[model samples]
Target: MQVKQVETETEQKQAYHVRNTVFVEEQKVPAELEIDELEKEAIHFVGYEDEIPVAASRLRFVDPYGKLERICVLKEYRGRSFGSQIIKAMEAAIREHGFQKSKLNAQTHAEDFYQSLGYQTVSGEFMDAGIPHVTMVKEL
Candidate 1:
């Protein structure tokens, strides 16, 4: 997978497409909840495989940490490591901005996956977008 920061309207759309498919359509998250006020301030990323967008995520500088948000990979592409690739790319961007920590509220089911990438569970289970989640953090 080739991951890149979204730099154009087209790239942004590709990111949204992946997010919508995974979060809204597949998971039934409310469409309104899928998008938030942070969109304009966050740094968006998209991953492409053979020129097709398959994954997406966004980053926000929340004080001492780079907050990862809206991370998702198309259902068909899960287990292919595209999520890890996009996350690595986001971490690189965080480091570029001098952040030493990365944080995210990961869906509970994916907690182990994030742990494998160096994230540690920081909080007990919670809910977001009607889905179970937990806060996780990693030292970059």
Candidate 2:
């Protein structure tokens, strides 16, 4: 598997396709909500397996904090650690921008997954897009 910080339109599209498959199609997140206005301002990352995009994520610099969002791994590739790779790549990108802390609104069921990566819950459970979520943060 290979993961890189997306720097071109084609790369960005590939990332979007992965997110579309995982978030919009499979998870029932509205297409409009999945692809938000923040796309243009965020740094994107994509993970590939044998030249096929399998995971995608983005980081938005919000002042003193770097916000991680739209992280998703294709259903067929879910168990392969591509999600972790994408997150690591985004964290590196955030660090490159001089940010020392990163945050994300994680699906509640996946809270443990984020915690395993050293993120801690920073807010109580909340509803986002009709799904339960929690705010998580990690110091980089």
Best by lDDT: 1
Model 2 vs. true fold: TM: 0.96
lDDT of 1 by residue, 67-91 (tens): 9999999999999888999999999
Cα displacement (angstroms), candidate 1, residue 125, comes to 0.5
lDDT digits (tens) for residues 1-140 of candidate 2: 79988989999999999999988889999999988898998888889899999998888998688999999999888887778888888888889889999999999999999999999999999999888999999999
lDDT for model 1, please.
Answer: 0.95
Candidate 2 wrongly placed segments (more than 4 Å): none
lDDT of 2: 0.91
* Poorly placed runs, candidate 1 (over 4 Å): none
Question: How good is model 1 by TM-score?
Answer: 0.98
Best by TM-score: 1
State how far residue 79 of model 1 sits from its true place (Å).
Answer: 0.7
